[model samples]
Target: MTRIESKLQRLSQIEATLVDHPEGITRAELARRFNVHRSTILRNLADLTIPVYEEGDRIFIDRESYLINLRLNIHEIIFIHLAGRLMTSNIDRQNPHAASTLRKLSTAIQGLAPQISQFVKGSANTFDNGSKKQDPHYMQVLEVLTSGWARNQKIHLWYHSQETGPIKEYIFSPFFIEVGAFGQTIYVIGRLDPDGTYRTFKIDRVERIELLTEKYAIPEDFNPDDLLNNAWGIWFTNQEPVTIELHFSWRVAQRVKETLWHPTQRLILQEDGSIIWQGEIAEPREMVPWIRGWGADVEVLQPESLREEIKNETIRFMNLYGIFAGSKENEK
Candidate 1:
């Protein structure tokens, strides 16, 4: 047999032994069982994700780390079910780990409350297109990124960036992984080596990635909450925060006031049932799409630039829908 096949068979044997013996077999015992040296056993275990605990001279696998029971309440179980359903859109449909996680949660909940399980089944039928069918290549990159993050290792990536106008090679010290809403792409948060600053990169845009031997230590001051405190979305900026005020018509005022949109958001209700919403943001670009989503029901009140842009957007919409002809008034 080839060396690769021998290694694969050894790894499979080690995993099976570890699973059967939760108390764990020692390094010497493992080496003896596999008919290999202690150094060879260590080498084989390096790539595995299993947690090892050393008590005296005996090294054993900590099974409790992988086998956890949260003992979730009904509401929490339902939330997990919904989140797992949503995650199906981001991850590949054939992803066994994600499928097993959802199935285990469903089974646990079904045993406790069969009625809720029935409701979940009925609700799941409504979302036939929930699985967005992610690219297998993207999934492979994500796996490497996750492993790099867990190991705190540096990764060399050939990334396609429009800003640089080339497929540039970068060494990144990845610290976090951000998965956006359902169907949205995944992003990697890392500190670029030469620049020594945090930047977010889309996972799918990475053309190539190679995990390096060097490891990195995350900064103590790295706080994602503080970094994204004033920004409207993912693009965190250090520029001065701008105050934005919007007036929502009475028709959509209640809907607008129902959710807390930002950390600095304030809402004032007028006597006519309209709402004056105000917030401070670092980047207005992210809010543009959300503002346009309201259409004629909302109007930007402060920040003349945003107001003008919204007016221009409305004019463009009118031109497309044939509401305004190619007339001088519409042009003005």
Candidate 2:
């Protein structure tokens, strides 16, 4: 390993050791454990960001200030394992920090939960193999955002908008980081500087980010859950909620009934085994792709505008495939 890489690894090890021994460990002991001099241990401790203190010759880290030390039961560990698996499967991008976190968790629980450790290790490997050629800047951008969020600081960033087809600069105060329900894509919700209008920016679209020293406070009324309460996905609006109704074919009725797709959703069963699903959503546009994913197994029954939009999209797809009304393909 390169010098910088080796130093970083050593620093991480020191932090982990400090967390494991919250009561305190002697500087001389840390130096002996890592086979380095006590001076080297002091330098590494200085580089650490966590709250570290010294009591005489022994070093200690504030467990309350450190977020890594967890006292989880077997069930909690299994739940975390499942969550790790889901994240590995859903996220298409490569995240080195995520892989490292899973690896560390796997190692930490290897003796207590051998089976789960293996699964978590497998998930970390998935990230490594899957992200060989992905975007290189994603991790760096995420790190800056995470730091800024944790410090309650503003960030100045250049954002590339797919819709606008241009790069724009914004000074933003990050209120929350959220993962979309449909794509599982990461987003940072915040207010634009000066104007202070709330906006959600996809992390992938962030071209450049610099954490600003200037800090900001989240509004007293700002609650991420409340902000996203009416959202179909990540797109919520100030307009009134639109009531959506969908009819599901009997073939997928049981599958549809297995989960509550939305908090406002209400389902009614028909005599023919078909199901009617209804919900109120702030932004219907985000649900379009999800609705289309069901193919012929579902139909949009209400909101004439949405129905028409879907109908038009279906017609376009039919035309693109050369499937005319009376064509053999359509008949099939």
Candidate 3:
């Protein structure tokens, strides 16, 4: 079943179990019933508004809250389920319990409709392929960031820096987490304490993080999207945004025009069915791989520096693949 379907189903199951066994369910029993670890069950319930309490050792979801239904129809529930699935699809890598959460929800609402259950089960099966295991340390860091953000607290981080050759310490006031539009990499954007200068840090690069009691107020004028006004991808430079122009042959014109390569991109259709793709970018190096992907069909038209860089890279590629340039041709 898809993650959302699984979550809904699991939630429905939990409600039914709680309702049936009104006295309470022990953590071990619940974990065994759900086929998840005790800790996973705890994490799954951490953010939920469900009233849970412990009597001696058994934990119980408040009967009062469980009896209060949302009165949602199957179609409405399915729409919400689909929305949750899309959200999970984007952040599944970062969120450890994303699948389990959806599973719980799916189980809770399974009997609402047989057709819905079948669809949810099918989707869950399709997306159930094994995913990459997350680093335990990374998960710890994520927890610290999440907690700090929720409480408006600051964080002290010991982050590994490859360029700097050592771990660096910084006091960061995390304003928000940013994920790639296509959901590639995740980032934490915040201001360095004391300096108050904004910076973006890769979540994976964080070696260790500690949540501090010191509170911080996010700048009222802060805007995350503006930070990427000139970025081609994730790497941002302080250099002035340069106008980049590319001419694509008619063969790839439609393909080029269809994609929004950058936020500042503009496409000009030529009479010959070719396309002139133009955009402003802060870092030209980031665009190298993309430009090279089109092979000989795309040509850099402006920003002499970028054009030269591409030309140099092409020559390097030709030299690397001597079959195309001829190894002995240089000697001749």
Candidate 4:
């Protein structure tokens, strides 16, 4: 086979393997599976023209393109286009920032979509929390997202998220939507367990957002209100609540007081002018450093247990690293 043809064939094989197993298949394993030397494997990687993520030695591919390439059947592509189009008008993808970001993305997914007719077939009305320009393409995404949300359905989405690592024959799934201040992002935040734990999968991060034909009925009692309310920041979870208390210096107290940390938070202003900020929390490990951002100006006053956890973590961090304070005594 010609050099280009060989790479194409091998790339197709890798795509098949991933289609069978979306979790991931490693590089060394890829070399072994194809009976190629490590060097040939490296060359194939370079010439394949597929994107992958590498953290140290582990390589992962999102499951997006798997089905698309597997079928190579026009009918399937047409179906994807039609289903994407049939989605109600309210479906929204995390609209990208108006910059080079969107430009790069629009360019990438150019050929990934099957056909325009599939999407535009069902007219999707467009409405949004932001400006309403009525972009036809954006309208398609909105329709798809809204359908996924309303039906409690899943979809295979094309997104860019942190988990996606190369071998891009593709993975796509539509499930939960990550809603943040800027807009909707390509992530599905849903329950991972019967006990009400949530795990989020990023849309673009994975190759495919395979919208399951099976519909999921959210238990009537599942209330995301508490879990969302207790978050320290964007990182959310359904973990148990921990009572965390923070003491703030007068200097930073006012600014901190004006904001709400959790819906359940209560503020007690001490006679000495210190503020005790107490709340039910989800994740303490992430919150400790934010508490320390005030330097010596803030203290963890309550939940003696959490104070100990913070103190131990602080000591461990200091021991593992070195720092230069502008202080003369420390310099000496």
Each candidate: what lDDT? 0.77, 0.86, 0.74, 0.56
Candidate closer to the true structure by TM-score (higher is better), 2 or 4: 2
Residue pairs with backbone atoms closer than 3 Å in model 2 (clashes): none
Model 3 worst lDDT window (10 residues): 124-133
Per residue, candidate 1 scores C-alpha lDDT tens digits across 7-31 of: 9989878877776764457889999
Error of 1 at 159 (Å): 2.0
Among all windows of 10 consecutive residues in model 4, the one with the lowest summed lDDT is: 120-129
What lDDT tens digits, residue by residue, belong to model 4 across residues 154-174?
455544444444433222233
Show model 2 residue runs off by greater than 4 Å: 1-67, 131-133
Top-down lDDT ranking: 2, 1, 3, 4
Candidate 3 residue lDDT tens string, 221-274: 777677778987666666788899999999998888787778798999999999
Local lDDT at 127 for model 4: 24
Q: TM-score, each model?
A: 0.72, 0.79, 0.66, 0.44
Question: Mind giving the per-residue lDDT tens digits that candidate 2 earns over 229-297?
Answer: 889888888898999999999999999999988889999999999999999999888899999999989
Highest-scoring model, TM-score: 2
RMSD of 4: 19.5
| Residue-level lDDT for 15 in candidate 1 | 72
